[model samples]
Target: MNENAESLSRRLIRNFNTAPTTHDVREPLYDSIGARLAPGTAAQKLGASIDTVAPGKMSCPYHFHYAQEEMFIILEGSGTLRVAGEMLPLRSGDVVFIPPGPEYPHQIVNTSDQPLKYLSVSTREQPEVCEYPDSGKFLAMASAGGERVFDVVQRRSNDLDYWDGEP
Candidate 1:
């Protein structure tokens, strides 16, 4: 088998029961799995992943993106969506759209006793920044406007002003 056989080859998954890579997130108590399905495919601009959150767990903190956008399709079980300070019920077959912006901060909370499964798709936008509302933090990755040389920076949400470091 070639080293890149699977990634470069086309295939079908009769069961979307899991992802190509699966891992346990103990701090949050959830299972995460995903495949860079399009990295070697024609759709290099898009990416997909499947996540299963244990009961009473969350996929991530309420956050919003500055460049990329995401869409999620609930595959099974039930959960709640925390969107811009609002809690919305989520269930199987529900589709969620999260566009880039500070107003679109969102998170998925497993509100049911069973595991919550969902398929998430997002754009591969570079030089992105993510804002975490609850933690008052900002995660930024600047690659000089998409250059391969990336600089990751994280700062508190209430940190200094834009001109704080200016001469």
Candidate 2:
């Protein structure tokens, strides 16, 4: 075993005794969302992280991934899962799998009066591109060899027909 692998595995086991936590926030950039108990900088380097959401907050933008796949397993409270064009009501112990593709743009919104928690797992080196179908927003990781960069674009309507006031 290499030194890097051994060091990482040791850090993972020893670091969990006191995990980092983040306060939930109502941020517009994330599209009306919040997260608590999110892994810190070190944990992200390992692979995945856990997140908690409060009531009236969304887990992420209603989006789909092109490379990274995510699974959300509810730990508490009830929420609505907007996947594809359908909304699935979810509660404690409910699990949802979002495969990597354009077909399943998924987001979880807490509708109950309590906090909801879940674990988010993905490969550390996977490249991801996310698209919000409803808002026509796109975000992807840029390859700049520096900090993670994002590209945003809005979808334009192709139908250019003019219509009168009458239906």
Candidate 3:
């Protein structure tokens, strides 16, 4: 460890509610404040974050990963979980597990009048592919040494044959 690195005890402990947040907003209904909790910790195979979504907003789109699995524990307020085309009610103390693949495309919408908060944890798998079923889009990402190497999102209609343009 570096001389200035945080001690083991400090690194292992994190407070989701008080952690600094990053705003993630995209037009109409996608808006949330996220506090990442795994970057400087000793954890090497998992990632975690605290996400807060305002009423009537969604933190992210309906998508599923090909290599990583995720779980969310609702910490505050209520919402609606849109999973596999079904809307399930979500409230504080609810724990939701989402497996990777096309069958479990999911998203959370804050339908209540108060802000919804949740702790999200997922496997840190590299070179992962995620599909957005609602928009017919997909994302391929690869990272090296904690840095992104390649990232691209495209529609399925843009795919080409394996031998296309090959000599």
What is the clash count of model 2? 0
Number of the candidate with higher lDDT, 1 or 3: 3
Between the candidate structures 1 and 2, which one is better when assessed by lDDT?
1
Q: What's the CA RMSD of model 1 in angstroms?
A: 4.4
Tens digits of per-residue lDDT, candidate 2, 121-153, equal 654443556777878766666533324566645
**If ranked by lDDT, best first, what sequence of candidates would result?**
3, 1, 2
Which of the two, 2 or 3, has more lDDT? 3
The ten-residue window of minimal lDDT in model 1 covers 10-19
Q: Per-residue lDDT for 55-167 in model 1, tens only?
A: 88886777899999999999999999999889999999999999999888999989899988888889978878888887777877754332446655565745778799799
Lowest lDDT sum, 10 consecutive residues, model 2, at 29-38
Runs with alpha carbons beyond 4 Å of true place in candidate 3: 1-6
In candidate 2, how many Å is residue 156 off? 6.3
Can you give the TM-score per candidate against the true fold? 0.76, 0.67, 0.92
Write the number of the candidate with greater TM-score, choosing between 1 and 2. Answer: 1
Each model's lDDT comes to 0.76, 0.64, 0.92
lDDT of 2 at 19: 62
lDDT, model 2, position 122: 55
Predicted candidate 3 versus true structure: per-residue lDDT over 1-167, tens digit per residue:
66555576566878886788899989898889999998777778899999999889999999999999999999999999999999999999999999888889999999998999999999989889999988999999998776779999999999899999999
